[model samples]
Structure formats: structure tokens, C-alpha cells
Target: MAHTINDLVGTDIEQYLDQHEHKSMLRFITCGSVDDGKSTLIGRLLYDSKLVFSDHLSALEQDSKTVGTQGGALDFALLVDGLAAEREQGITIDVAYRFFSTERRKFIVADTPGHEQYTRNMVTGASTADAAVILIDARKGVLTQTRRHSYLVSLLGIRNIVVAVNKLDLVDYSPEVFDTIERDYREFAAGIGIEDFTCIPMSALRGDNITESSPSTPWYTGPSLIEHLETIEIADELSGRPFRLPVQWVNRPNLDFRGFAGQIAGGSVRPGDRIRILPSGLESTVDRIVTADGDLAEAVAGQSVTISLTDEVDVSRGDVLAAADEPPGSADQFECHLIWMSDQPMLAGRPYLIKLGTRTATATAATPKYKINVNTLEHTATRTLALNEIGVCNLNLDRQIPFDPYTASRDMGGFILIDRFTNATVAAGMLHFALRRADNVHWQAVEVNKRARARTKAQHPAVLWFTGLSGAGKSTIANLVEKRLHEQGFHTYLLDGDNVRHGLNKDLGFTDSDRVENIRRIAEVTRLMADAGLIVLASFISPFRAERQLARELLDDGEFIEIHVDAPLSVAESRDPKGLYAKARRGDLVHFTGIDSPYEPPESPELRLDTGGAESAATLADRVVEHLRTLGLLTPPPAG
Candidate 1:
């Protein structure tokens, strides 16, 4: 019987597998601006290395003949660009991951998108990569996307870099051109804090200096691209750091083996070592270590293992187990390098979910302290982060979690921001440092309590919260309510949004982050006024439910009354008094609630009033006052 291809492959496969099982893998990414031949370079590497089989190569040749953009030449890019859109547009729209192996090492290659708008895709690819090959077109050297990609790889902490000065054949393989581009890139990279990189001259399409040193560039002496990669030693930098494992699952399947299972995020662990559960600050001794391949004596960073503690501690998923003496610090507030990913610009004060390791927390990103100009490497002060923008910002987590600086340990330090509503990944971040005040500051005990201050003024203090769409009569009703309170001779203060923004929050704008801060300041002032035994009336759109809930948190039970002044979108738009809704309709306003942005109404407000009807503002005020009196929170004026 004639041997089939599968039968021949089974017999011949082992010949290619000799010594391959022992080789450690290297994960690297190729990135550049659109049409820099990143996918082609990867394809050329696979071909030159003899990793592509005869049948696959034949199919690739046929694919190259069909949709290939290069005239009558095999489009090596076809190997990596699997999507039809990528081939049709001749541009990578998504990250295309591929795999191949060599005699010395196995490899995982990430072909990242290069467009400025797809910068977030580049970030996602580079996040796990150990090294980066940033390509520059010899015809057009050191463009903005080149600089942008260089900055991102640096930010992601990729130490190993190879600057492939590609398409040398197009520039007639000019040595001077390669040198100038290399020198310029070195200078730019230095400003971005990338201290070291190796530059090589190559034409990924023509296969110069890809696997073998190019004959075209006699002046260049650097090793070939594949030679550098094969010999490059990826340092196991985390081995020296403190051991940390974020418990992903509590394996109490049988109750007999209560092992905490997770991948070792940093350093090493073994039996008999003492470990602490973070945030809780509890300690226990390691009793046993288990793995699918039987019991393990020790496990290093990157290994997944199940560990049993001597004591039955209150360990749970999302908890970090760390070396007792060298555990990471915990803080509710963190300074992070944020890479915004969503079309909706990052709203600093609005609630987002940050999933770090196995732990997830409600977090608010402060308006970016500064935005990074990828082209210029300048730190520009900015209020919000749009899609693909990188910025430095402060993140306030709902609770403290174990963390190390992203520089020291990526596994323990990196996190992803998830949109609370859509559950889509909205951003990626790296923890830089914990805010010092979060750990160092202590609350001073006040001598006077709320009840004592209230008694002194002989009145009850409260915050009257009026929330609704803009032009929904929120401010009108709040003003009327405050007038009634003032008439009763009860000490009172009114905080109107426009009035407050002109002074206290003058630096803020209409961005979501700014709105959150605006409401936050108002809530704080309302609490302070109530503390002084004055009833406070606060009126704002307070569009987000999270921000409204945050205001309620600032007040004592029953002291905060959320009044949802309800009105339909049509009613509010029709009654646009300040012409703000008109501006929003004209597309002058972005993130305008009920228009472009979302408005989450209070699920169950303390008071719900329909203001779209002919109901008078005075009628609404009387209803509120009556409710306050019923709650024993109102006092009548003495006879004047």
C-alpha cells in the first residue's frame, strides 16, 4: 500500500522534534506603522528557518499569488495576516499571533497593529512579550508611529529591542541611511528611557539580514536578526524578587485537600516557608505543594501550583499569598501608567472595575495628571484620556490590594480596567507607586459628634440631593426647597452646579472625570454644612448612579436624601433653558448624558418627582418640607 501524507508525517515528525522539547520559549512581538512589513518579516523568518512545511509553503505561495499586494511576488505577510480585511486593506487591523520553533528555542510571535488609533492593540500584544522588533521604513525613517511604538514597548518594560531598518533594498541598501535612522532612533529611545537596543539593516521582503547577515550592507557589522534572537539570554529577573501568588481558586473539592491554586506571580515558593495573606495581614506556614504532575518541592515564578497551609486561614480567591517578610505593600490609592483602550474617553471619577491578579475592585481613575506625547515624549497636562492615549493618573481602589511597582514584577503589578456596564476591557495599567498618604495618614478623632453639633444649633441637619437631566428643573426645585428652609430660620446653604464650578472646581470641565470631581466637592461641602447644623441643598445632573451613591456615602444614614427630579429626554430637550441640550444636539458637547453619554437613573431614590408636568416647583418644595417634618428633621421659625 502507498504511504499517505499523514503516515509519512508521523514517521518524519520525530526527526524535527529532536532536542526541541528541552528548548525554552521566547515570546516577542513585531511592530511598526502601517505597511512596515512586520508580518512579512515574521514570515521571512519562519521560511528562512525551515519551520514552514512543504505543503504549507505551497499553500502560502498560492495565497501570495491570489490576494498578495506585491506584484507577482509571494506575499510573505499572508502567513501571519489571516483575516480577510487585513489582506484586502493590506494593513493589520488586529493582533495576529503565530508560533514556530527552532533548534535552540521555541517561539511565540505577536504581529501587532501599527496605526495610532490601534495603539491599544499594540499595548495588549506587547504586554506579554519578552522582546520587541520595531521596524522603520528606510524610505521614511523615524515617523510618528515608529516613535509611538518605541515608547509603548519601553512602557511595557521590554528590555530587549531590535531596530530592524527594513526595506533597505528600496533605499538601495544605503549604509548612511541605515546609520542615520539608527542614530536618530537611539537618541529618541534614550529620551523614552530605553537605554539599550540593537539596530540591524534588513529587507524583510527580500530576506536580507533576516536569517543570514546581509551582503548589501558591508558597513554594518551587527549579527543577523534571527542570530541575535537565538542567542539572546532572557533574564529570569523575578527569581530574586519576593515570592507572591494571587490565589485564583480555593481547591476544597474533597475538604481533605484544601490547596490554594494559582500561578506563582513572582519569586519562588517551597514547603516549610512562611507566607502571609495580603490586605488581611494573616500569616501561615506552607504544609504541602501540589501540581498536576505530582507533588512539587519548590515552584518558581510562572509555575502554576496548589499549596496547602498549616493553619486553616481565611484565605479566599483574590487574596495574595506572599513571602511573609518581603510581602508587597497594600494601598487603596495608587499612581499608575494608564493606557486607555475604549472609544469612551477615560472618565477619571466614574467607577470602573480593575482586575489585578485575581482580585477585582471598584476603582476611579483621577483625571490624568499628565498625558504622554508619544511623538515628542512630552508630558502634557490633560483632563481626560481618549482612545489609545497613555497617561499618568491616580487610581482610587475600593479596597487595598497587594502590589509591587510594575518595574519590579509585571505579574503582580499589571491590571486591566473593565467597564462596569458593558464588561468590556476599557484600559490597561501598571502600578507605579502607592500614594504615601493612603498608608501614612491617620484620621484624628473629633471631640464633637454629629448629634452634639445638631443639639447645639437646636435643629436637625440634612443634605437635600436633587438629581436629574440638565433642563429637567433640578436646580429650580432645589432653589425653591432651599428658600423654604431659609424662611423657617433653619441655618441653610445651597450648592448649585454652575455657581460652584465658577469658584471651587474652576479647573474642571464637562468631562466625566470632571463631573465626578465636581459632584464629589459638592457632596463634601454638603456634609460640612450639615456638620455645622445647617440643612444643605445640592443641585446637579449627577448623571452617574455610582457618583450619586458616592454622595450618599458621604452623609450619615437618613441625613442624605436623594431626590430624583424625573423628566423624559424629549421634555428636557424641549425645555433646554441654557441651550446646553441644544449644544449637545449640535454635537458640540461629547459625553452629554441622555445624548452621547449614558445616564443611569437612581435605582430607588428617596424621593421621585415628575417635573415634566405642570406641577409647580413650589408644590415640589412643600412636598419635600412635609417629608422632612414627618422625619422630625424640620424646625419652624420663631414669631418674628
Candidate 2:
């Protein structure tokens, strides 16, 4: 039988083990915007190092013949461009990973996409890379894409940078062209605080200064691309950083064994080392280090290892393990630098899911302090963030989360925002610092109950939850009821969906999880209002029955009046007061309640009004007011 590709890869791994004993591996990524010749550069490096197998070489030769390029000679770009679409389009759309080895070093290269549209994919590749090869065409020196890639590399905390100035052949192998680019890039790097940068001139197509010195450029005397990569000192890049290991999974094999398994995000860990679990702040000593092969005395950054603690502390997934002396602080609020990726702009007070390392939590964008101008690096005071824009914003987590400053540690500080409903990543954020400090003064509040406040106000304060489909006249009817109550000298306040949204609920959206948190926050606000001796009239779509029930739980029995504003879907569609139903019907909107989403109607309600009839808003308001009066919430008429 013949060995398959998987089997061949396994065999290669075994051969690699036999050939290289006690040798460490270095993983790096090639990153740049599209048309930067990243793939060609990587292909040239692999070919010059003689790492191409016979089968791969034969395939490349066959592909070159089919493409009709010069007598079946190797088109090096074909070596890494495995995707059919990539081959046809001549652009990388996803991260293509390749592994090869030379006698001096073993390497894993992540060839990241270059297009600005694929910035998320680039970040994904650079997140795990120790060094970055930023390709720049000698013809176009220091383009916008070049600056963007450089900023990303620094943001990701990739310490070592190899600026491979490709296509020297096109520049007539002139040292001046390379020197001008090098100087221009150095100025940008210095401004961004990137101190270590190595510039090398090379022609990836002609194999000039890739593995061998190019005779074309005698003035340039830097080491070849391959030589620089083989000897670059990356061991000290993450060596001095503080230890941080985010527990991704809890490993318990049997009754006697228990351990936490995750990749070492930064620094090193050894047996008998004391570590603290953040948020819980529990201290424990490392008992043993375990891997797939066997036990080990210690593990360094980038290694995947399971660690057992001696104290038997309650540590779980989403918890971070760090050095005891320099532990991460638990904070509920953070100020972060964010790069928005969604077309829908970021609205204030909208709740979203924040994922950091392996931990996920509900968070809200508290305020948009400023949006940074990417071109000038200037801060612009803005209220909202649009797609592909960078901004500095404050985030309030639902619960306390421990994190490090991005300047201090990338692994612990970087986070991504995921749309809770679509599960699409919408933003990449870097934590600057926690806005709220733990050592701040704490104040205790005086005791006050909701029922006593309602009695003192001389009225039965209740939340009038209006539930219905869009265009069901819920907000209009709630407004009328508030007017009638005010005329009758009853203390009442109306919380309309649009009105509250402009201020209190400004940050919310129509996403499912956002909807959930929206109702949760509105319910909390309504609960506070009812406790403050006022009847709160909340006019919202309040689509889900479960969420409405959650709101009801925050109040006493009979204090939450579920007002079902009943109207047929067809009638609501025809009304289309906001023209939103038409848009939803045309599939222009996603997650629109009553169109795509299931709007659970209220089973029972204190007041049910059929807005489809000839009844006016005044008549409905009168009916609700009469009911409140009968409940003794309103004073009787003096001379009726």
C-alpha cells in the first residue's frame, strides 16, 4: 500500500525527530498587504534552502508547464499558493502555513494575507508568531499598507522584524533605493517605538541574496535573508516578560490526577513555582509539568503543557495563572484601543461579548473617548466608530476580569469582540489599562425598599411592559397613558424605546445578546424608578417572553403590568411606521424581530389592547387610567 499525505507527514515528523535531537523550533510569520510579494519571498527562501521534496518539486514543475511559464521551470509562488482561488487570483485570501527545515534551524512559517480587508486573518497569524517578515516592494517605498502592517506587528508585540525589501531586480539592484526605503521605514519605526529592525535587499524571483550573496549589489553587505533568519536571537524576545498562562481546559484523567492545560502565553513556568489564579486570587505551587511525551521540569513560552498545582485550589477554565508577585488585577472597567471591523458602527451603551485569551464575558462600550486618525495618528473626538476605523474606548465588563496592559504584555492584554448573535468577530482591542482601580474608596448605601417608597409616594408604582411586534403602536399608546396620568395628577414617567435609546440605551443594538442585555438593563432601570416612588411606563418591543419574565422577577407581584399591544403581523407589516418591516421583508436587515426572529407574545397581561380596531389612543389611555384608579393607585374624584 502507499503512504497517504497524512502518513507521509507523520513519517517526516519521525525522520525529523531522528535527525534533530534536543533542538528547539522557531515559528515565524510573513505578513504584509496584498501585492507585497510575501508568498514569492517565502517560496524563494524554501527553494534556496533545498527543503523541497521530489514530489513537491515535480508537482511545481507540472503546474508551471500547465501555466505556460518558460519551459516548466519552477514558479516559486506556486509552492505556497495551494488554494485554487489563490492560484487563479494571484492573491492570498487566508493564512497559508508551511513548515521547512535547514541544517541550522527548523522553521514554521505562517504566510498571512496582505489585503486590508483580511486584517483579522493577519492578526490571527501574527498573534502566535515570534518574529515577522514584513515584505515591501522596492518600487513603492513605505506605502500606507507598509505602515499599517508595521503598526499591527508592534501592536501584536512581535519584537523582531525583518524588512525584506523585495524586487531589487526592478530597481536595477541600486543600493540607494534600498537605503532610501530603509531610512524612511526607520523613521516610522522610531515614532512607533519599534527599535529593532533589520533591512535586507533581495530579489525573491531571481534568488538574489536569499540564501547566497547577490553579486548584483556590491554596496549592500547585509547577511542573506536565510542567514539572518537562522541566526536571529529570538530567545530573549519573550524571556524576560512576566509569566501568564490562561487556562483553556481543565485536564482530569482519573481520580488521582488533576491539571490545567493551555499554551504558555508568556514567560516560563517551573516545578515548585508559586502561581496565583486571578479574580479568585488563590495561591498554589506547581507540583509537576506534563506533556504528551512525558513529565518535564519546566516549560517556556509557546510550549503547550499541563500543570498540576500542589494546593488543590479551585482553578477552572477562563482563569489565568500568573506569577504571584506580579499578578494581574481584577477590574470591571478597562480603557482599550480598538480597531472596528463591522460595517455597523459601534454605538454607545451597546453590550457585546468580549473574548480575551480563553475567557468570554459580556461587556459594553461605556464611552467613545476618541477615534484615532490612522494616517496622522491624531486623536479625534467622536461619538461613534465606523467600520475599519481605530478608536480608543472605555469598556465595562459584566463581571471582574484580570488583564495586563498591552504595552506590558500582549497575550494578557489583547481581546476580540464577537457579535453574540452572529458569532462574528467585529473588533480587535488592546487593553491600555483598567479604568477602575481596586484600592479606591468604597461607600455603603442606606437601606431602602421598593414597597415602602411606593407607599410613601401614595400610588402603586408598577412597570408597564409593552410587548408587541414592530409598528404595533406600543410606544404611541404608552405615551398617551403617561399624558393621561399626568393630567390626573398621578406621578408617572414614560420610558420609550427610541427616547431611552438616545441616552441610557444608546449603545444597544438589535442583536439577540444585545437585546437580552438591553432588556436586562431597562428592567434594572425601571426597577430603580419604581423604587423611587413613580409609576414607570416602559414602551419597548420587549420581543421575548423569557426576557420580559426576567424583568418581572425584579419587581413584586402585580407591580409588573404586562401590557400586550396585540396587532396581526399583516396589519403591522402594512403599517410599517418606520419602514423597518419592509426592509426586513426584503432581507436587508438581519435578526429583525417578528420577521426573522421569533417574537414570543405575552401569554397573559394586565391590559390587552387591539390597535387594529377604530379605537383611538385617548380611549385606550382612559381604560388603563380607570383600571389604575380602581386599584387605588389614583385618588378618587372629589365631586363626580
Candidate 3:
């Protein structure tokens, strides 16, 4: 194993410790199709490196006899697959990290799952990896998942790749077989922009060509996997990029000492260096680079240190300290590449919490520009991203944040999208660049604001949002409510679903993505009308709760009233006011609520009307008007 001193007890302990401490570290991941022997390969590495303890090795042997897949031989995979479920199924389910070292270098290998369903877990393991080991069964050649993993490795910027064609003994070590697989893999890898890679033929279970060259493959001429890993040059590119330190905390043990604490994400920083705070553009000089040991003259990327600023600037947890000369850009909107990981599809216009570096912001995504078919490498058009899907989309954040392109610095550009309701991580994304419009567009101030317009009209602006299924009497009741408001000398506007589709949302369909966009458009319009001091009545079958919540967030407190026109599917279908239900049942309509699609009813609406009851549409309208009157919305402005 790369000239390692295995006799730990015999050698001078001080000398060994010094040698080990000086070795550089490399992080890598193993991934491929299921049963490609990823765990076995890692277990072999640990075993050959003499890292496993004798007691642990004894347990592995006993377990191998009971549960091994190699005909009662020492199943090395048992060393890595520690979980009971993984052992029982003989598969890798989660990312298992293992540390082993040789005389040349220290290594941390991640044994990632190869199943298509656990692709997200694989991505997590590869995100920080410097290289990737893609195993392929000699019998199967190149499968779809092989291409998928390779593409992901390329996408994650793992330039160092080694295609380990395991199970070479299964093919009788034929030179022709090895040549064919190597040719096919090289062709596929070139298509995905993998310019250079090393291919090694080996059998992990038999321990051939692992730590040493195997005599079985006489025609094969290449170093073993461990030799390549130790010799590969994985340059420290982050130190050359622009300096960035996302303040994780404001370190203040006492009033006399105050410094910002965080790991330097990119480049180096020193005392007296000019720095700028992001999203604020405030400038200052670094006062001291403090660490646990003491103040330092300099610190580079990946080092955790606290630094005090020369000026008393307003810096907090989410602020980024950057080099004044080459600072990153800030933007509220961006185009990014997203890897959807959750079971629920990613819908356009629905807000999700985005965690980038040390900052968190509310983000809404537009429909995907395209989704990549990993197997074929084609960009196919799609409205939404499903589980394990990769797509390019535009995201609008609630506020500006500093970032670099992912290619420049991963820590400054990578982000994760979390579900606001469940707090589950739903997607991982990379910032390509901020959209130009995000910088160019600025909100123009007006002298006459919403409060002045409302006072002039002598009424409070409100949005009476009526939501329900089609043929549920929502439109009819909303029309009656607007007529009553007009009769009462109030300025009102009605935005009906069908009428808006004919003009405003003419190109939109009834798909989930389109529905989110539909509600987004209507919410913006509703906000504009309310700003004009007009009572806006918006009627639509807005199906998703997320979109409904978006509309609520756009308005001021108590300004948007959600009125659920409750009606059973059976009752609404029986009414059939527009014969839409019959068309849906006959398969003439697709994505129809209560038919092929789903409709998420509001959980706690401001008002609920039982449209299926004996109450007529006019009675429901009067109930709405009375509810508004009780809430003080109907009261005229007090005299000045």
C-alpha cells in the first residue's frame, strides 16, 4: 500500500506521527449502478491499508460466514455496510464514510449507494469529493446508471475520475472484453465533457489489482486504484479565487472583544486588508485575524478564524466579508441548476426557503427552461421537476445575497432549497449567474401611496379571494358580491378564472405549473388593484395551498380575505352549470380538479360559505358583505 510502515509498534512512534501529520488528505466517492461492488471496493481499501482493528476484522469474518454473498468467503463489503438493513439486503443504502491512510497520503472515501432511488444521497457524498470512482460490472458493460453517475460526477466538478471495471475474473480476464468496455466508456465519458480519466480492470472480491498489480491481467498496464488516488493532483483552486467569509456568528465573548467567526470559504485574508460587507457595500479593514491559538498574520481557505473589523459596521450572521477589489456580485434573482430530490414535484411560483452559505431567503422558482435526460444527455422541455430530476430554472429571492459562479467557488455558489412547511431539504442547486434584470430593475417611488389612495376613495382596499372547484358556485357568488358592493357605491373589479384565461393567462394550461403561474399572475393583479383602493374579487379554482399562501403573503394583514366556497364533488358535478364535469368524466378534459387533478382546499380561510346548503347565491353574497362590514373594511375614512 504505497510504502506504508505497517508495524506501528516497531517503528519510532514520534517519527510515524510526524510522517502521518504531514500527509495531504483527499476526499473521494464511489458510485455506480446497483451491485457494482462499491462497498466491497472500499472495504478492500481499508483492509489493505491495515487500518481495521483485529477485533473488528474478526467480527467481519464471523459476519461474512453468516451473511456473505461470495459463497462463504470473506465478504469485505461487511466492513463498510454497517447498518442491519444494508447487511440484510446486501446493498448500500446510505453514504458510508471511511478513513484510511497510507505512507503517501490520507484518504476519506465515501461509499455511496448506487440505486436510482438513492441518487440524492449519492449527490450528497459527491458534493465535496475531489474525485469519483465509478465502478462497472464487466458483464453489464455500460448501463444507464453508469452514465447517470458519470454525468453527476462531471456536473459536481469532480475532474479526477477512475472507471474501475470490477469483476474482471468473471470475464476470464480476456483482453478483448476489457478493450471493448474501455472503448465504450471512453466514448460516453467524452460526450459528457470528461476529458481525462484512468481505467483499471480489477476484481474487488478476489483482491486483484487493488493495492498491488494482479498477475491475472497480463495485457492490462496501469497502476492499481490506490496508487492513482495517492498520485493524482487535486489542486487547491479555492485559495486562488476571490476572498469570501460568510459570517456564521458574531463572536463577542465580552464588550472589549468583538469579531466575526466563520470558515474562510475562498482565498486568503490578513490584517489590514480592505474588505467589504455584502448586500450593504460597506467598507472596512481587517483589524485582527483571531484564532483559538492566538492572533495570526494570515489565514487561507478552509481555516476557521474570527476577524475584527477596523470600522464599527453593521455586520451580522448573514453578512459576507469579501475582498474589496474582487468582491462577488449580489442579486435578488438568478438562473440556477436544480436537482429535485423530494417526492413531491417542484412547482413554479411556489415559495421555498433557500439556504445559501450562511444566509437564508425566501425563493420562488419559475418553470424549468429544460430538464436533462442523464442517459441521453438531451435537454427536454418540462413544466415541473420530479424526484431525481435535474433542471434549469429561474429563482427569485426575497432579498439580494452575494455569490460566485459554482465553477469559481462551490462554497459561495451552492445552495439547498428547504420546504417551508416540513423543513425538509427538497433540492440542491448551483448558482450560474444572477439574471441581468435583477440588477437593472428598480422600484420607482411614488408620492401618492396606497394609504393616500384609500383615504381619497373613502374606503379600505381589500381582495375578496373566492376559491373552490369548478361548478361550485364560486363565480356566481363572487359576481353577486361585486354587484352588492357596486350598489353600495364602492369601486370594485372582478377577475374571473375563465375570463382571465381568455386574455391575461391565455397561453397557460391547467397543469400544476400553469396553475401556480395563474395564481401568481392573479395575486400580482389583486395587489395592484388593492393599491388603487378598489375592492378586488378574485374567483378561481386555485388548487394548491402553496400558491394560495403566496397570494396571502403578497397582501397586507387583513387585506386579503380567503373565502372558501365549500361544496362536495358530487353536488358540484350534479349542478354541472357549464357541463365541465361531464366533459371531464368523458376524458374530454385533462387536469380538471376533482377528476384527474387535485385541489387543495384552504385549511383556515377567513370565511367559508356552504354553497351546497339551502342558502342561495345572493344570501352568500350578503354574508360576505356583512363579514366585511363587521371587520371595519366598509367604514368610510374619518374626516381630517
Give the candidates in order of lDDT, highest first. Answer: 3, 1, 2
> Compared with the true structure, what per-residue lDDT tens digits does model 2 show for residues 364-477?
785579986655667899877787677888897867787888877777888999776568888899998887553473446767665566666667777888888888889888
The global C-alpha lDDT for each of the candidates, from Candidate 1 onward, is: 0.86, 0.81, 0.92
Q: Model 1, residue 260: displacement in angstroms?
A: 1.8
The prediction achieving the highest TM-score against the true structure is: 3
Among residues 3 or more apart in sequence or in different chains, the pairs in candidate 3 whose N, CA or C atoms overlap within 3 Å are none
Runs of candidate 1 with Cα error greater than 4 angstroms are: 1-18, 53-55, 444-464, 476-513, 525-537, 552-563, 569-608, 614-640
lDDT by residue (252-306, candidate 1, tens digit) is 9895779899999889998999999998999999998999889888999989999
In model 2, the Cα lDDT at residue 571 comes to 87
Predicted candidate 1: what Cα RMSD to the true structure?
5.5
Worst 10 residues of 1 by lDDT: 1-10
